[model samples]
Target: MSSEVWFTVLVLLVGVERLAELVVSKRNAAWSFERGGVETGLGHFPAMVVLHTGLLVGALAEVWLLRPEPPSVLAWSMLALVVASQALRWWCIATLGPRWNTRVIVVPGLAPVAAGPYRWLSHPNYVAVVVEGVALPLVGGAWFTAIVFTLLNAALLRVRIRVENQALAGLAA
Candidate 1:
């Protein structure tokens, strides 16, 4: 198979993985809501969804349109980063357990989680997200998609982190 075919398969697998995450997230959201979790950052939620979906779609589109042939070294390195990011993302989810969801929802009176990836960085999942944003597209030699997603994700993360912190603060209060 051509590199483009392989790249398409990889992107499709990632999309399936994302679907799995949404399933987990939806269940977790319900768990939080049942426990009186208050959700913040509603306004940005749609944008987040759109941007992420765009990442997958844009990567596929760019790869096929441009038909870039990245060096084997660059492709392999980006692929490694993509895998690592997925691992880190799942680590965050497992650490948070039922508390982990796509949206920022905090149950009152519960202390913030300080275990797992959180032990090192406050928002380790975003680190995974940032890495994947750049690496996934480049794995398929889609540099334009990588650059655009990275910039947009950075702006979105800025707002997301602020809202999440405030929600966590409310939990502490």
Candidate 2:
């Protein structure tokens, strides 16, 4: 198959995967709401959505516009990193279980989750995110997309982590 066809297939697969994540996050959000958990990051949700959407759009534009021909070795390496990041991301979700809503909802008196990837990094999911943000775009030789999204994500995560930490603190106290 042509690279264009491969790119289309990859994009479709990512879209489907993101849809699945939304479904899971929505269900988890409902569960948290039923349990009287408080969500603290409502204000950032829209920005987060926009940023993620931009990442996809920018990646596609880069692939078609700049059309940098990457070495096969680099392409395959980046592709492997993308897959690994997904695995790590799902591991985070599975470990967190119902507590893993996309929203920052805290249930008081539950020890902050420390299982799975969280055992090492305080934000393993972010690690996967950082990796995937760069890897996905680079798979199509979209260096600009990777760099832009990485910078945006870093800024966004700074605010997100602060908000989430404050919320979790309320539960811890």
Candidate 3:
């Protein structure tokens, strides 16, 4: 199989990984909500879902239809970034543990995490997200997909980070 085919498979695997995360997220969300967690940013949740799903679809579509040539150097670099992004995302999840839900469900009276990546960055998970959003598409030579997703993700993260900060306001302080 060609790299293109492998890239498509990787994209599909990412979709599956997301579905699995949702399962964990749902359980965590329930646990948090049970402990009087208040969720903010309900409005953007659906848009996030759509945008993430569209990323996979757009990546595949671009690869299948356009077949852009992925330069070896760029492809490897992007692929490394993708792997690093996944590592960072998992680190964020593990660091947060049950407090890490896909939604912004904050259980008040509890402290915000400030270790690991959180020690260095306010929103380290978003760093992973941004890198993956751009790198994943580029792995398949989907420049258009990368560009569009990066722009939209940027817009979404602006709202998301603000909402998250509000939700966790004073916890880390």
Tell me how many clashing residue pairs each candidate has.
0, 0, 0
Worst lDDT run of 10 residues, candidate 3, spans 164-173
Candidate 2 C-alpha error for residue 124, in Å = 0.6
Q: Please, what is the TM-score per model?
A: 0.98, 0.95, 0.96
TM-score of model number 2: 0.95
lDDT per residue for candidate 3 within 1-173, as digits (tens), equals 98778988899888888998899899999999899889989999999999999999999999999878899999899999999999999999999999998999998889988998999999999999999999999988999999999999999999999999988895655
| Model 2 Cα lDDT, one tens digit per residue, 1-173 | 76655765776687788889899999998888888888898999899889888888888887887778878888899999989999998999999999997778887667788889888988888888889899988888888989999999999999998998899778768
Instruction: State the lDDT of candidate 1 residue by residue for 1-111, as single tens digits.
Output: 999999999999999999999999999999999999999899999999999999999999999999999999999999999999999999999999999999998888789
lDDT of 1: 0.95
What is the model-wide C-alpha lDDT for candidate 3? 0.92
Sorting all predicted structures by TM-score, with the top scorer first, yields 1, 3, 2
The list of candidate 2 runs beyond 4 A from truth reads none
Best by lDDT: 1
Ordering by lDDT: 1, 3, 2
TM-score of 3: 0.96
